[model samples]
Structure formats: structure tokens, C-alpha cells
Target: MLHLLPLRTPLAGLGLCVLAGAVHAQDTLTVYGIADMYSEGIWGGGGRVSRLQSGGLSGSRLGFRGRENLGGGLNADFVLETGLNMDEGTYGQNALFGRQSYVGFGYEPAGRILLGRQYSSLYNLSSDFSIFSNLSNGPSSAVVGGFGGYEPVRGSADSSTGNGGPARINNAVKYESPVWGGFRFGVLGGFGEVTNDAGGNRVVDAYARYAQGPVDIAAGYVDDRGGSVTPLAHRRSWIVGAAYSFGSLRLRGAYLAVDDRSVANQDGSGWWLGADYRLGVSLVKIQYVVNRPRYIDNARTEGLGIGYEYSLSKRTTLYTGVSYFRNQDGAGLGRASFSIPSGITSGTDNDLTQWVGGMRFSF
Candidate 1:
């Protein structure tokens, strides 16, 4: 069950309580969702697979959010988002609200504190500098492994029980600062939910960024304790990224590193570069990503992806893409993110190639 904090004593005694009540009565709530599907084909070291599935272009999802102006530059806000699979007719992320769920109050020029399951600060900042917007392309791909979301053991993940690791943490408390002169930051921590562990069992993340004119710079770090309640068993990652825009053309670059003290042979680092050109409502995007796992020879992986997207309206878009991956000696792990997760598995095909076509609609 989700817990809510009690109002401060002073605020409760003063007229603030009444004002909050009045504002709460005028709050607004809205329902929203996105649907994306794709046809995908892949040839990997594992095998050749072709299938239709939900793509990660925007990660099909449904959400409900609301806000209430509480006066004095303060406001109450909450979000509940769930991942959905249009093809399987099932909830994608395993939890009732897997994508995001948080409630908090915000101050106009200060910041806000939220409580519940939420996205890592690193992921949020990283997306700002990604041409692919943290999709299954470019340097964002390496982020999966860096954040300890990599499935080195395969088969199943802690988040899904049979898929992969967690993207959002539970029992989390987060703080996000308001932008000041194009500068902002966010921090987060997820308790282990165990009594005896104390501060050792927690997931912590932080990020900061500055954007002005045509240039943007961002940096982030995350220390994940994984599923263990032990302090030393931690997986950590840090990244620095930048993006620049000129007219209709934009360029993005990033360097990411991971310290996998919790897993053997999983420690590694990599980088990515991306570019895109916008022509009215249409865009062409391409990215190159490389991953190097520590202590493993010929066990490196790299990929190149090219994609095109056309917006049909404010809430609809059409997209298609192709990806090619090369896995050195022992590096051909499992699958590459072809947007279509299932169809892109690298089944023993050292050279993994994939094709995808999809459309997304939001309402």
C-alpha cells in the first residue's frame, strides 16, 4: 500500500489547510495512453527470428495524472503510468503501475519532493541528450548494461521474473529542482524495504543539466544495490553527454561507464554518437553504439541504426528502421534492441541484422 505523509503542523494550523482544501476541489485529472506496434525481422548468433511485437519507440503505455494549485507557488501533483502490450493484451511491466507512480508537491522556483516508484535521475537526464530519446537505439542501448539492467545470466530478470531487470525502483523518494537559467537537477533513492539493512540497502541516483541556445550538457550517476540487501553488492554507473542543434540538424554524443562490483565479467564501458535531421514534420535519425565488457577478449559488441519518422498529427506517428550489430568472439550475448524486443534476439548469428516498421498513436 502507498503511504502519504501528514501535513506539517504549522501548515495545518494556519489557513494553508483551508486553502489546500479549496485548491484540491478544483484539481484536474486526465487520462492518457500510447500504442505502438511493429513488424520486425532479425538474424543473430542465436538464430533467425521474425515476428510482430510492441516496439520501444515510445514504449506503449497508459497513464493518469493530475495537479492542484495549492497557492503560494506550490502545487500538488501525481502520476500513475502503466506499460501495456497491444499485441499480448497484457500489462507489460508486471506491476499494476510499472512505468511510473509518484505523488508530491512542487514549489515554483525551488524544487519538489516525491515518494513512490519513479524513474532514475540518470535515465531522465540521459534522454535529454539522446537523438533517439532513450529509445532502443544509440548510446542509450549501452545504458541498459551500465545501469545494471543487463541480463548477463539471461532467462529471467528481477523486474519481470522472466524478462529483465528493473528500470524503475520501488519504495523510492525523489527530489527534482526547478530550472534556473536553463539548469536543473534530480535525485532519487529507493529503500531496500528490509528492516535490518539500514542505509546499505538502497538505490541512489542523481543528475544535472544545463541547456542554452543550441547547446546542452548533462551528467548523471546511479548506484544500484540490485536485489541484494548487502551494502558492498552494488552496481554503479556514470555518464556525461552533450547535444547541439543548428537549424534543422542536430548532433549528440555521450560517454558512459559502469562499475559492476556485484557481477563478474560484467564491468564495462562504452560510448555513442547520434545525428538527426528534421524536415518539417518528418525526421531522419542515425546512431552508432559500442559496448565493451571487462576482462573478456573479443567479447565486445557494437551496432549501427538508422530510422525515419513521420508525424501524422500531434498524437500519431509512423516509423521504420534498420539495425546491424557485430559481436566479437565471445561477445554475441543475446539480443539487440531492434525496437521489437522478441524479433531481435541474436540466436547464434554473430552478425545480427534487423528491420522494423511501426506506428504509434497517443490519446
Candidate 2:
């Protein structure tokens, strides 16, 4: 058995698991976090953001998690993660523990079933082929609408729950299968908690991946019927990506397509290619990505980025990188992941450039 303190103010699905249990001697708890900051500037007329900022290379966050063994190949676990804005001394995500908060059960041979707020399989699958790990300031987030709902391209919260439901689904149930020979899969569904409307604001996602040897490949899909009342918020998207490595060098690429079912003319399609080379504690990376508006003329977006990172220790590192994007033909695409409190827009036809230097600590 396991026991957890009830949340100060419950948010629907939360606190249910805590109320149903008590801590057991077999349970284990631990804390973990990361702090990252950077100094950045644009090439030409740089904005007011020539100063320091948080989350240049990674988001700062604190998390508490634990798991308990229950014999018979079964166990219980939970995670509570809160995003930190090291720059402003405030929370990053909109809500408390906004990064992730969930509870679940695991059956060794079968898989794990989790409930609460958690990432969808589409978000998880991107890690296999996204050289940038879908960072907010990276190419993947600019062109890949399916990278994650938190991307600038999809920042608005769902109307039903007023949350980042599409990025990290709320009131959702998920199942992750055990990996077998570098292969694994998962499925999830976010229930639309509207009154008497089963299809309103419903979201579904799934993915499969294979990671063996020096090669990796993955594909993901997401369908969101944002609001049953209006068809203006619905969308269907998918992505396919693969990577190959030679010695200390790794190369990767991905193709993405999005159907703006709500506004057909705003659909997007694009591809990206990236590479990384690691020399002991030092690493070098580069990538080029583009996005083309489906039915809009002169609205194509593309850019190139290069970066370097050197580790000072096992949990510390200093890094720097530069990126350039030409929003020609009204391409209007820019960094949608990590904004430095300055105004940045995507799907614009203006060229954009930026260089950033920063350090990170992980524990």
C-alpha cells in the first residue's frame, strides 16, 4: 500500500489515488531538477532580449516521484513535476505541477496504465528522431506541428478545460507496452469532460518506434476535435522520422504534415535534416528545417542552425549556438519553443536570426 498527501486544491482527476492509499515500507521517493540559462541576441536589429534568459538549452524544473512494489509482478507509481522560471523566480507552466502530475499501476509483463496529466505518445515518439529533443528554440518545434502542443504553433489551451490539454492531455488514460528488442509502442485518449458531449474536445494519439544499433525510426499521429460547438479548432497531423549514425556522428531527418481541418488554407507541410557529432565530453550539432503553407501562396518557411555544448562535469555544461531563418514568401516561421520575453511570430514572411550562449546544471 502507498499513501500520498492530497493536493492543496484538487484539479478534477488529481488526488484520487492519494485518497485511496497509505505509504508502505517498500516505497521509494526521490527528487530531481534542472536549471538552465542563456544570453541571446539577434543579428540585425535585435530586440530588448539582448539579456539573460531561462531555458535556452533546457527547461528548468523540479520533480518528485516514487514507486512501490506490490508483489506478483505489480507496482504503483506517481510523478509530480513543476516547471521553474529560474530567470523570473516564478512558475513556467500555467498551473502548479504543470509540467506533469500523474498516478498509475504497472504490471511487469503487460505494461503500465497511467491517469491524470501526461504527455501523449506523439510527443514521446519525437525523441527517437528529433536531434534537438524538440526544444522550444529548435527547428523541430517550428515546422513539426505534432512535435508537442506546447510549441508556439499550438500555444492556446483547450477551451473545454482551459489547460494545455493537447500538449499534455488532461483527464487522460495511457498504456505503454514493454520494450521488446528495442521496439515499443503506446496509445492514449483524452476524454472530453464536457457535459453530455462525448465527442467534444476529444483528443487521441498513438505511436510506434524501433531503436536498435545505430539506427532509429518512429512515426506518430494525433487527432483533436477541440470543441464540439465550433469546427474552427479541429486538426489532424502526422510525422515520420529516422536517424542513422556512423562512428561518433549521428544524422537524422523527419517529414511532417498537418491538416488544418478548421481552416483548410492554413495547413502546413515540411521536413528537417540534422546531425550531431560527439567527441568525448564535447558535442557539435546542426540542422535545417522548412515549413510550406499548403494552400497559401508565398508562405514558405525555412532556416538553419548550428550549436556546440561542452560538459564541465557529469551534471554541468556550457553551450552556445546560432540560428538563421528566412521567412520568405511570407513563410512567417520562427523559434516557437523558447521565447526570450520578446515578441516572436511564426508563419510570417520576415527573416529572423539569433545567437545564444548559456549553461545548464542537471541533478
Candidate 3:
């Protein structure tokens, strides 16, 4: 359920009463969430599995947000959001408020400043410009971002290593600029907070985006310094993406590259192209992605995905999708944003496939 609450305060003193009246008129709070679940059959790693899962099209989440207008075109706002696993009735991201927790202030013409855990700039770019919007299932750019676990840049609670890049940074400070001529940019820095080590597990990310009319373009970069007790490797990644819309059809594409400084020949790159078409209340999407690893000999993976969505209402949707991945030379890539089961390995020249049907409700 979603709720909006208006706050009011009555003060004892007449002067205080006047102050409360001014503030009460500008404060608002809201609670909202999405519930998503899917049934799927996945075939890969020499086995087939059928089950129900959460987050097929989008991750389920609950969140609270509030904003206070401080007058003079300035405002303060905060958000607390948590991911949910609808299937198992569990927390999705391991930590409470793992999806996002931040407080910030914004000026109408200047921009905003925020502090706390938040999404990385690279993730924002990829999600915005991709047809799937980096959903948890089907053919998503997440697979390319985390290919072979060499560059899992998605934010996580773990700050000790950069094995998977932080999708959301912890203990972070961020700044976002106001849009100018359809251009805007943001920067974020995450503090590792390791004792006696200022730079341990640190993260720095930045992104710039421009959108006008039917064209949108964006680029982002992230550098994660991995290490808790001892210094490990540093993971650096960059991405560029673009999207164009014409009538009922939208086309998008993105390219991403990753470099791990700890190991030689561990760099990799990936890219995807996708399109979406809308017909009345129904939508169709198709995407193709490729991943190439520099460390593996002739190791590569390609994925194709097709999806359909029907809108029953503004708040309800029915969706189905299928994805197929072809892996060569021991490349062990699985479905987008999903992990291969433990003890099951995709051997050389193996292939993987997934079929999913689901419903989503938002409030």
C-alpha cells in the first residue's frame, strides 16, 4: 500500500505557532513499493531447474521518502528503501535499506548534495539507456557487466574486495548538478572506513548525461580500490550508452570495459543492442549482448532475449521472456543478474537457456 502523509504541528507559544505553520505547509512524506514475482525454468550447467523467483522484470522493494521545502527554492529530502524477495519472503540485498538510504538537500538552480549509500554512476547510465533497464532477468546488461565474475560492478554490501564492483557504495558523499541545456552530471565518493587506512576499499564514480527530445546519451566511470586488511586489486570500469526513440519504437545500445589492476590480461569488454516497440497496451522488447574476456583463450559468450509485457492497468503488468546464451571455450556466463548454482559448472562450449513468466504490481 502507498500512503501520503501531511505533517502538522501545534506549538504552545504564539511565535512558535507561527513558525510551525510555515513549515507544516511544505512538508510531505510518502511510502511506496513494488511486488514482483516470476516462475521460471532454467537449463544450464548440465542440469535443469524449475522454480519461482523474485525480481524477474524488476526487483521488489519498499521505500519511504520525504521532502521539506525550506523556502527560497531550497529543499531537504531523504529516502530509505529496502529490496525484498517475494518468493522466499526474505530480504533481497542482505542488508536493511540495501537498495538505497540517503539524505540530501537541493537548490533549485544549483543542484543537490547527498550522503549515505547510493547507486553508482555507471549503473545509472547502463540502466537508463538499456531496453531492459538492467532488470534482474532475461537479457539484461547485468550479464555483460558481471561476465565470469571478472567485473561484477553491481553495488553490494561487501566492501573488502572489488571482485564484484560496488553497485551501491557505502559511506558515500555525492553531488549532482542541475540540468543545463539538457546536460547534467554527478560524482560520488565512498569511504572505506578501514582503521588506519584512508584509501582501503574506497570508491569513486562519475557520470554525465544529456537528453533532449528523442535522443539520450550518457557516459560513466568507476574506480574501486579493493582491500580491507591488506591491499588487493583495483577495479576500474567505464561505459557509454545512447538511446533514440521514434514514434512507438525505441532503440538503445551500450558498451562497457573493465580493467583489473591486480592481474595481467584480466581485462574485458562487453556490449549490447536492444529495441522496444509499443502497440496500444502491449510492449515487445528484444536484445542481444556479447562478452569477451582477455584472460581466457577464445572465450566468449553471446545472449539473445525476447520479452512481452501487457499492461492491465497503470499499477499492474503481466510479463514473459526467454533468454538463450551460447558459451564457448569454457565461458561460464549465466542468465542476466542470476548466478549459476553451486557445484554446477558450464564447461567448454556449453549453452544456457531461461524462460520466465511473471506479474508485477506497484503502489
Please name the candidate that would achieve the greatest TM-score relative to the true structure: 3
lDDT of candidate 3 over 1-363, digit per residue (tens): 543445443432334434233334547666788999999887876777888888877789998787888999999988889999888898866678978899999998999999987888777777877777776567777767553354444554253353224677778899999999999999988887777878777888899999999999999998888565336657788999999999999999999888878645378888899999999999999999887776777777788989999999999999998998777765454334466554344554367788899999998
- Residue 137 of model 1 has an lDDT of 34
Q: Please give the clash total of every predicted structure, in order.
A: 9, 10, 5
Which structure among the candidates has the greatest lDDT? Answer: 3
Q: Provide the lDDT at 31 for model 3.
A: 74
Off by over 4 Å in 2: 1-26, 44-48, 137-140, 143-155, 158-163, 228-232, 263-265, 331-349
Better of 1 and 3 by lDDT: 3
Ten-residue region with minimum lDDT total, candidate 1: 154-163
Per-residue alpha-carbon lDDT of model 1 for 85-173, expressed as tens digits?
88898886678787788898899878999998777654554566666666653224533343234532111234532111234667788
Report the candidate with higher TM-score, 1 versus 3: 3
Cα lDDT computed for each candidate against the true fold: 0.68, 0.69, 0.77
In model 3, which runs have C-alpha deviations exceeding 4 angstroms? 1-3, 9-26, 147-150, 156-165, 331-336, 342-349
